[model samples]
Target: MHASVKMQFDAIANDYDRQRKQLIPCFDEFYGMAVSLVECEPSSKVLDLGSGTGLFAGLVMQKYPDIHLTLMDLSDSMLDGARARFSRTDRVQYIVGDYSEYAFSGQYDAVISSLSIHHLTHPDKQRLFHTVYRLLRSGGIFVNADQVQGHTPAADAYYRKQWLEAIHRSGLTQEAIDSSIERRKLDINATLSDQIGWLEAAGFTDVDCMYKYLDFAVFYGKKA
Candidate 1:
């Protein structure tokens, strides 16, 4: 992650959890679908990339109480929020580092990320997919709930228009909305089809997008 991007997230770390539902119109369904697609045993070891504030990992932990998780992110301030969230628990471990360059050790039964991977350039996203494939144990799954680009220019316009309308109606303060918009400048989203292709090329099976609402999507593949 770029230093500016990390700084942006660090600045918003305190307000991120409260603002997430408002920023994302389909917040419940988007995250619920991603959690549903994660199939693992109760004691499965899981890894989360770009795990800002541990929101997604918290959801996964709720579903599998015994699952051990390693959460990685680029900003210490964001990780501080995660530390607070899981303060009394030993099952969760927090690592402050860039997921793209981090040297992951040991195999994982499941890997998940939400609303973070889009910050990487398209080529980096493809390379990260390959790294995730290599890090997973056989039959393990990788699930990503993030944003995607529309296939056509008109479709892209519609996506942006709908997002703007939804956020305006979400009752957030104008200042908050402006900050969100500024942060979005770092996004480098890929098309859903292209992401699925990358996952398949990285040696995943049954690669498919499980859900989508405009630019928001939940996609995953199983290592085979």
Candidate 2:
């Protein structure tokens, strides 16, 4: 599963950024909410997990240019795209590794992820929330802008149906759509309630879903 994710993302690295707007039905509001919740000092250290193509990090940089941003992903090709997106600067660093298992060295002011994490199994996702809690400084925030399963089997099916309908009419090429569907085979989304419980169990405070549009949602919490 890990190797498959790496290979598939590497194959689409070059076009990942361009296709995001079409792939996500609520691209603007989704990202806008995520970035807005990333409140921290201007020069604080921020870590982005599964930071493919650095799209979310770039937006965060726009908001806080002096921030020390670390982008980690399983796919080096995706980080290559990130390297091109940002200028050569000491403020940005890229690492090619699995976010779920990496032994990160220090704490951060804020930890964020986008369109990733759903690829992990439910247990992995819960473990990751605990990891994020431990990695955060006091009062630090964690925000995840990713997909989730619906409350029930029928609702989950409906969410998938709606997403498919939206994406089909979203103007992406057939090849791109097909590739996305193939990549989605790796998704193991947890329900919103389960995720909130995981966050709370991980020692996060003020835990809440800041926004939700179908399966795409922005979850936010802060370390106390």
Candidate 3:
């Protein structure tokens, strides 16, 4: 992750969770579908890349309580929220570092990320997919719940317009909406189709976009 992006997230660490539902129009269904697609046993090992505040992992834990989880991110302050969220549990672990550059310790049954990864440059996103593929055990799942760019210029413009409309109707204060818009300037999103292709190129099977609404999408794939 870039230092500027890390600093940006650090500044919002305190209010991230509160702002999430307001910023994402399809909050519940977006995350709920991602968690549902995770095929893991109670004892499965999971790694959450860019696990801001552990929100997504928290959802996964609700479904698989005994799964051991490692939350990795570049911002310490963001991880602090996650630490507090899972403070009482020994099954959760934290690593403060860039997910794109970190050396993962072991293979996992499932690797997940949310509202992250889009910050990476296109080349970095491709490399990260390869890394995630290598980090997963055979038959393991990899799911990313994040935003994507449209395939065409006009479609991209429409995506932004639609997002602006939804945010305005989300009941957020003007100041909150402005802050969210500013934060999105750091996004380096790829098209949904490109990401699916990248996953397949990285040797993942059953690669597909499991869910999508405007620009937000949940991509799912598995190692053969």
Give me the candidate number with maximum TM-score.
1
Writing each residue's lDDT as its tens digit, candidate 3 over 199-218 gives 99999999999999989999
Q: Model 2: number of clashes?
A: 0
Screening candidate 3 with a backbone cut-off below 3 angstroms (N, C-alpha, C), the clashing residue pairs are: none
Decide which is better by lDDT, 2 or 3: 2
Candidate 1 versus truth, CA RMSD in Å, comes to 0.8
- Badly placed stretches (over 4 Å) of model 1 are none
TM-score, per-candidate, Cα-based: 0.98, 0.98, 0.97
Model 1 per-residue lDDT tens digits across residues 7-122: 99989999999999999999999999999999999999999999999999999998998999999999989989999998878999889888888888899999999999999999
The whole-model lDDT of each prediction reads 0.94, 0.94, 0.93
Instruction: For model 2, state the Cα shift of residue 38 in Å.
Output: 0.5
RMSD of 2: 0.8
Regions of model 3 farther than 4 Å from truth: none
Which rank order by TM-score, best down to worst? Answer: 1, 2, 3
lDDT of 2 by residue, 116-168 (tens): 89989889999999999999999999999999999989988898898888889
